[model samples]
Target chain A: EDQVTQSPEALRLQEGESSSLNCSYTVSGLRGLFWYRQDPGKGPEFLFTLYSAGEEKEKERLKATLTKKESFLHITAPKPEDSATYLCAVQAGAGANSKLTFGKGITLSVRP
Target chain B: EAGVTQFPSHSVIEKGQTVTLRCDPISGHDNLYWYRRVMGKEIKFLLHFVKESKQDESGMPNNRFLAERTGGTYSTLKVQPAELEDSGVYFCASSRSSNQPQHFGDGTRLSIL
Candidate 1:
């Protein structure tokens, strides 16, 4: 079974602080790795999709980087509004088997 | 474009009662998915629909859950005789294609007492 494990189940940071969240995975053949941000009582919002190792994507203060075995979401100078649960999911195989196996998620709280 | 939307932002019910959740995917999206996040657990895929067809449903926990996407425009998931363990957030997501990024709705929070 494809599995995703996210580190630091809960994190607290001061406004403008920078840190990175880690996601480690094991799959038969990784088709894609996804990053999502979820707020309290809300569904997850897509962030980035990493298809191959050494690939990276950025949006505002968030930068997502991937490797063969893990992925990292780096938040640069985060604001209080950035507080949310960061989810990491992995899709294995292809075609109709596009289901995503998600991790438990990392809860981030940024204090102003 | 409008994002995916789900009805009943919150629902509270007693055990053994039936509840039906609805979802309206973004226009032009062909792939619809159902997922659930139980408390203290990861979000898990329940099933997927492609243009009104059941493409994959390997993750469905049991026969108590039934999902349908008639006409391929909207979808519904019904849980009969709901159990206490069924309390959680049920989310709906849609994608343009199989490999595209899936967009999610705000989710329906179900609480069984």
Candidate 2:
């Protein structure tokens, strides 16, 4: 079974503090690794998609990097507005039914 | 251009009642998907549709759930005789292509009493 596990179920950070969230996975063939940010009552918003190992993508203050067995979401100088649940998902290239298997998510609380 | 849209932002119903959720994907998007998240569990995929055809319904929990995407524009998911275990947030997403990033909607929160 394809599985995604995210560590540090909850994290509290001070303003300007930098940290990284971990997401480990096990799948047959990884087609894509996705990163999303979800607010309390809203749907997840797409952040990045990593296809291969050693690939990295970044936004304003968030960066996502993928490896052979895990992925990391690095937060640089995070702000209060960046506080949300960060989700990690992986899609297997197994077949047409290759839907995403999401992690339980890491709840980030950035105190300003 | 509009992103994916779903109706009934919140729904509260009694057990055994049927509920139908609707989703209108962005114009020209061919891949539509349905997902659900229980209270404290991770979000799980329910089904997927490519245009008007059901590409994969393997994630569907049981036969009580029925999904249809007609005319390849809008989709509906109906749960008959709903149970308390089915209470959760139902999310709808759409992607222009198979391997593209999907756009999501502010899911509908379903509560069963």
Instruction: Tell me the lDDT of candidate 2.
Output: 0.94
Tens digits of per-residue lDDT, candidate 1, A61-87, equal 999999999999999999999999999
Worst 10 residues of 2 chain B by lDDT: B96-105
Model 2 interface root-mean-square deviation: 1.0
Per-model tally of clashing residue pairs: 0, 0
Q: RMSD, model 1, all Cα superposed?
A: 0.9
Per-residue CA lDDT of model 1 for B5-55, tens digit only, reads: 999899999999999999999999999999999988999999999999999
Residue B81 in candidate 1 has what lDDT? Answer: 84
Query: Whole-model lDDT, candidate 1?
Result: 0.95
**Clashing pairs in model 1, backbone N/Cα/C closer than 3 A:** none
